[model samples]
Target: MAKVLVIAGDFVEDYELMVPFQALQAMGHEVLAVCPDKSAGDKIKTAIHDFEGDQTYSEKPGHAFTLNASFADVSESQFDALVIPGGRAPEYLRLNPAVIDMVCAFAASAKPIAAICHGAQLLAAAKIIEGKKVSAYPACAPEVKLAGGDYADIAVDDAITDGNLVTAPAWPAHPAWLKQFNELLNK
Candidate 1:
């Protein structure tokens, strides 16, 4: 089974993070869920399905051993692939130097980097999309282009390979990310 590391921060879309993650696990691949910080008690909070509520909810950060391992502690030699889930998580994760290095390691090793929605923000910050062709949330199109990627209107499931990169528009269109990501992972 391929080892895949899922990088998520707070406000990660519940479906976006949970669905693909479980799907990857169901496929018999080894998956690790990593958040920021190395803690035994620190928890990442996620709001219940509403983006505009003052009552954002959160699950107590998972057990430190199971909750998060520092991005700084990660090594490219340890994982086979990377999947970035979207949400406010991207906005914050993009700022972490360790996470940036982790994202860069994926491309540095020529591993597939799959992202959706605001997840593209993290990719954009890592400068991995330069001169690459991919797709993301329409709102993020300008950002993607600024990072050197061509925002594609095409569906993500379609096998459009733009120089070793894969893209999906948003969380709602995840079948495409799933298809394209699985394809890249198995390769």
Candidate 2:
């Protein structure tokens, strides 16, 4: 079983954090859900981002997701893959040098890395998306381009995998996202 690391923080998308965490575990992969500055047993407040035909997605308070590991203790060598769930967390997480460094480490190792929605912000900040064919929430297109990555603004349920990276627009694309991510891990 692959040891998977999931990066999350306060306001991370509810379904984005829970579904992959549980699904990966059900598939027998060891998944570690963590947040910066948070230790094992700590809880992160999650937000529910739902589409309701508005100009933008709606956000609502969600459950607290518990972290099973400590970010300070994380080592890229101990994990086979990295998962970055999207939400408001990415906005500030991208500003953290430690988070960027960890992301760079994962990229350097060419391990499977999956990101969705605003999670791509971290990748953009790490300067690892350059020349990559990436897909993320439509709102992140400009950032992706600024980072020198090719952005694919496709359907909400579509996901794109390029090399060791898999990305999608949002949680609705979980099926495609997880499937591609699983294939990458098994490779």
Candidate 3:
């Protein structure tokens, strides 16, 4: 089974993280719920809601789960893919030296990475999107371009595996995102 790491921190789009997590679990993959040492709570919240909603759903950490490891300690060699959920989490995660370095390693190795919503912020920080085709929330177009990725209005599940990288828009694009991700891991 593919071992996927889902990076969650403060403002992680609740569903952006949960949907793919549940989907990957249903497929029998080992999904690791990870949070930077600094993300709010154990499970983290959504920019809209703490639980992956635009309203106010928050998943308190230690309720039933927690991040597998700290960003500083996680090793890319152990993961098949890296998933970064959108929301304000990326905003802060982008500034974390550990998160930035880990992300850079993922891209350098061409490991499959799936990002949604504001998660583009993390990529922009890592400078891993250059010359690659990607999609994200409209507000992040400039960041995408600045990071060197080509922005598009494509569906989330378009399966953009360009030499081991994957990108998505947001939660509403989960179905397509999950589908493409499943395919990537399945291979």
Candidate 4:
């Protein structure tokens, strides 16, 4: 079974974090969820971002996600793949030096990385998206462009895989995103 590392923080998209974490575990993979400056057993408040016929997504309080591992204890060599969930957390996580470095490490190692929605912010901040094809929430197009990545504004239900990186616009694309990541890990 593949050992996966999930990076998340306060306000991480509810389904984006929980779905993949549980689904992967159900598939016989061992997943360790973590957050910067947080230790094992620590919990981070998550938010539900759902489209409610509005111009944008609506946010609501979600479950408190518990970390099963410490961010500081993670090593690129210890995991088979990485998962980055979206939401308000990425906005600040992308600014964290440790988070940026860890992301860069994963990219440098060419490990399978699955990022959804605003999670692309960390890829952009890590400067690893250059010349890569990526997809993310529409609002992240500018960031992808600025990062030298070719932003594919595909449907929210679809996922795009470029090399070892898998990206999707939002949680709505969970099926595709997780499937692609699963294939990559199995490779």
| CA lDDT scores, all candidates in order | 0.72, 0.95, 0.75, 0.95
User: For model 4, what is the alpha-carbon lDDT of residue 19?
Assistant: 99
TM-scores of all candidate predictions against the true structure: 0.81, 0.99, 0.83, 0.98
The reply for model 4, stretches above 4 Å from the true place, is none
Per-residue lDDT over 100-137 for candidate 3, one digit per residue giving the tens place of the 0 to 100 score: 88889888888788988788888888999888887887
lDDT leaderboard ranking = 4, 2, 3, 1
Backbone atom clashes (below 3 Å) for every candidate: 2, 0, 12, 0
Q: Is candidate 3 or candidate 4 better by lDDT?
A: 4
Model 4: worst 10 consecutive residues (lDDT sum): 94-103
- Reference-based lDDT, residue 176, model 2: 96
Kindly report which residue pairs in candidate 2 clash with one another. none
In candidate 1, stretches whose alpha carbon ends up further than 4 angstroms from where it belongs are 38-42, 47-72, 155-163
TM for candidate 4 is 0.98
Model 1 weakest 10-residue run by lDDT = 57-66
- Report the alpha-carbon TM-score of model 3 versus the true structure: 0.83
Give the clashing pairs for model 4.
none
Candidate 2, residues 27-143: lDDT per residue as tens digits? 999999988999999999999999999988999999989899999999899999999999999999999999999999999999999999999999999999999999988889999
Go through the candidates in order and give the C-alpha RMSD of each one to the true structure.
4.6, 0.6, 4.4, 0.7
